[model samples]
Target: MLYLSQFIKMLLIVVIMLQWINPAQAADLTVSLSDNQGNPLPNIVVTLTSPATIIEEAEFSPQHPAIMDQIDRQFVPHILVVPKGSYVAFPNSDSIQHHVYSFSKAKPFELKLYSGRPPQPLEFGQAGEVAMGCNIHDWMLGYVYVVDTPYYGKTNARGQLTLTVPPDDYQLILWSPLLDSKDSAVQYSVDVAADSKIDLSLKHALLPAFEGFEQSDEFDDY
Candidate 1:
């Protein structure tokens, strides 16, 4: 009985130690973005993709729809990042109606004039940037970046994003609508083990924000 009790205690200790050394513990990856002028660039989408991350698994799994809201004639987020095959709802919170549409090749669709949430969300089946604008309010511009990987985030006001992911080798990708079409996506090879940080600077100055559509009397009737 004494030997059995000792064996049980040893087993308990081993179990506790094993739990402390769990390989599933998530690691933090900090990504910092800056423009060529060394100023923090916010609203940039960052994604991490690895061989272990199955795109099909993420596509099949149901995810809560993301919202691209309009308030005061502008897209609240300006840039939204979502996993490929996810749905995005355009909710108009402003008093005025908004007609949101995207001409980008990734996803091309339009939400006719509406004042509230649409009945259904639109799915972004492809992995690319969707540049959106309001047909009625030409100045209103926004973007949706759809990525194949499930691990993604957007930079905050300070141009910093932290992602918790399993330790593995991954390809880090960054995207922004302001970037030129040819250089929109920047990729880097990263191996994440323990907590790590990466700093990236844009090669060129970002394009100026869309001010407004060319003034024309064609729409003077509203």
Candidate 2:
């Protein structure tokens, strides 16, 4: 009879320990950014940085699971953020030939014009907003916003973004190609809880927009 009682007590302790080691939930956030006029800004980048502690069950991997493509003489998702040391594939998905090139702070590589996947995809081995353009199609311009964090997302036409992030302390950053002036970007600290709702709104950058054909004009001016 004593053995049976001891067994029951041990089982209860094991069950309680299991519950304490449970994983944290992913946080929920609703982010938005715009100009003083409240106009919706496209290509807005939102970043949620976790605290130094392990809020996320998984650490950020060096291998980024993301890709950007060139189609219809345009780069899909004009802006993207990938973890550092990530391999971003730039596959050509259009009928016309494309000559991909980038001159950003991150990786600076180029691909000659080719058709049908061009053997392999261009690997972006660094982190930065590398500006991409096509020599053949001057009007073909795109921007890849390379980021090191894992929890990030871009806003849609509604100027809002929802990204699944591990619960932790984060340095929230708001980025956009457009903003009225010095107020183009802003970063703040936030404590993200699992499934918690967060929101933000900021002005767009007032800088000149990317014009694929602008390169041609620059040469002519010189």
Candidate 3:
């Protein structure tokens, strides 16, 4: 009887120890973004950064370079998300030539007159939004969001994004090409505990709509 009692005590101690060793499980984070009119906003980039997370730096020459193809006189995939210190290839798929350039401080360079892929892809060394435009095609606009953290995603047509992340604290940043300025960008401090879902709305209206490439005298200066 005493031996059985000792065995039962040992089992209880083991269970308690196991509970302490394994704590809570990580969770998935979902973010929903919409414009002021309560309509879903697409192509909005949602970025999360945390001090506890470690982001491996991408070398100047990345094995898989992000491709931004130029087609139908417009930048395909209008928004591109790239890791910091990575390379991006601007491939001109259309028969017409393309001259891509960006004034963004993250990485500013001019790709002068290219028919196919450039000799070397452009490198993004910093973490910020890079606005791209073709010197020849003024209406051809695109954006590249360089993120230092791994927990980042762009919202879809439904303005929703989900990321599996460790349960911790983070700083969330929401950016859109249509934003009037950086001052209007949405930023929030949030804590990710168990599976979390957050709904966000933009403060300002998006830029005026210019769906397709229209002949405008303003484009002459570009």
Candidate 4:
């Protein structure tokens, strides 16, 4: 009788874990990216990748948005963050029509020059940064951060990001377009508590980013 009771109790515990517990917790995480010499990096993209063990779900995803403009022959915000597989709409808020395209490795698509809003948002279903350009202007440039993990953020001018996450040991990653190292990814181990701060400094710029080309060859694939 005792053995049977213990077995029943164990089964109940397993059932509760499968049905009641959630695998992922929603935590707020902040991140900062800088050069090898510790200068704040703007327009650098960050992403939280999954460890090899996780097979079912992604680490994170971005919300939906479709905002683009051609004011003064420039792309507003310069850089954007989006979830993999989400859609982004292009609205020509300028008097003249604009042509937009990305030759980045993740996914490349083009919107032929036309005024007003485009019919659909370009859907990117990968976790990487997609460089955007106004094919007409050699000076116009922008970036899209396609993130798969939820714990990510952009740094301010001071290179600061505060992340809220469940208190646990995690692998923290940082990336920038001009990271002194190869891919600009500086990895660290973090134990994030409530409002805990992780301050980091990086080296100097490694490569001279060409103004005209938005190619993935900019970095060595870090």
Candidate 5:
């Protein structure tokens, strides 16, 4: 009888240990974005940065090159989020030539008229927004958001993004090309001790939507 009692005590201790360790594992942060009308807003860039998570330039490692393809005279993704110091390839899949350039202060360079992929990918060394445009196609516009942290992603069709991050206090930032100049981004202080969800709405109405390639008169010319 004593032996069985001791075995039960050991099992209880082990179970208690597991319950304590489970909370230390990474947790998910579900963020849902909406516009003024409460309609789900997609393509919004979301980033979570902790004050303790300071990244050094020497520790920055570039992941697989990101692709910003030109298809049917429009940027495949209207907005892209990339980590700082990462490379982005501008591949022109269309038959016609494309000159992709960004005047944004983050990374400014011009890819003169070209049909195929550029010889090399351009590196985004700064952390800011890079607005791209095609010299030949005036209405064509796109944005590349460069962030310093890896905990970043764009909202999907459902206007929701899930990020797995260690338990910490983070500053959640949201940005979109459609955001008004006066209110470019929305930010909040989030304390994530476990799986958490946040619902955010834009303070101001978004700017008019960009003209798609199909909607432009230039579509028939090419």
Candidate 6:
């Protein structure tokens, strides 16, 4: 009887340990955004922030530095997303010199005119949108979306984004530079469980486009 009691206690401890070690189930989230006319809206940044309890318990680390290349006097990736505290590399691929600067309160820094990669990537320690522009090119614009949570995705040409994340309640944010600069992003509360899909329709039309850029009707974040 004494040996049986000890064995049961050991089994109970192992069960408790297993429960503590296991993580919650995960799910996939797909988001689609479009204009009132049903036209796809690309370059939109979407972020999902889980509850504080889930954030503290979530096991995730920022990946390698992201790259924002300067090509043809424009930012290659007009919209860039990175986790908080992640580094971003600005490589000037064009022959002409390019000076990158941002006035954003989240991270404000300037890379003096250069033709190649900088010594080190710039670190984004805060979670907010950073609007950067080239001093030489008035039309050159880009956006850096720094998010604290790991669950985020940028919309593709089809205005669709898909990402996998642990099932939980989250705060969802959608940002687009084309939206009136005054109100560039929208936020909502969502509960994600099994594979889910969300369609977002903008309440206001996007701002006017820059005529001199590649597409006369196209606009990028400033």
lDDT of each: 0.80, 0.64, 0.79, 0.63, 0.81, 0.77
Quick one: best lDDT, which candidate?
5
Number of clashing pairs per prediction, in order: 0, 11, 0, 20, 0, 0
RMSD of model 3 against the true structure? 4.2
What order do candidates take by TM-score, descending? 5, 3, 6, 1, 2, 4
- Report the C-alpha lDDT of model 2 over 1-222, residue by residue, as the tens digit: 999999999999887777677656566766665555677666667777654532232123324345677766677756756655555666677666777787776867787756675445445556567888777776767777766677777778877788776677788876655544455346677777756555555543357776644444323322
Candidate 2 wrong stretches, greater than 4 Å: 1-16, 51-65, 203-222
lDDT of 5 by residue, 93-208 (tens): 88788888888999998987477546477788899999999888877788888998888888889899999998999999887777876555446899999999999888789998
lDDT, candidate 3, 128-149, per-residue tens: 8898898887777888888888
lDDT of 6 by residue, 141-164 (tens): 888888788787888899999989
Worst 10 residues of 6 by lDDT: 53-62
Candidate 4, residues 1-222, lDDT tens digits: the string is: 999999999999998897668654545556655555667665555544445212244322234455666566677667767666666767666666667888998878777657654556667778787887876665667777777665566777766676555555677766655555644555677655444565566655557867444332312222
* lDDT computed for candidate 5: 0.81
Candidate 4 lDDT (Cα, 0 to 1):
0.63
Q: What is residue 122's positional error in candidate 1, in angstroms? A: 1.7
Report how far residue 71 has shifted in candidate 1, in Å: 2.0
Please identify which of the two predictions, 2 or 3, would achieve the higher TM-score against the true structure: 3
Steric clash pairs (candidate 3)? none
How close is every model to the real structure, measured as TM-score? Answer: 0.78, 0.72, 0.80, 0.68, 0.82, 0.79
| TM-score (C-alpha) between model 4 and the true structure | 0.68
The deviation in Å at residue 127 for candidate 1 is 1.6
Using lDDT as the measure, name the better of candidate 1 and candidate 3.
1
Q: What is the lDDT of residue 113 in candidate 1?
A: 53
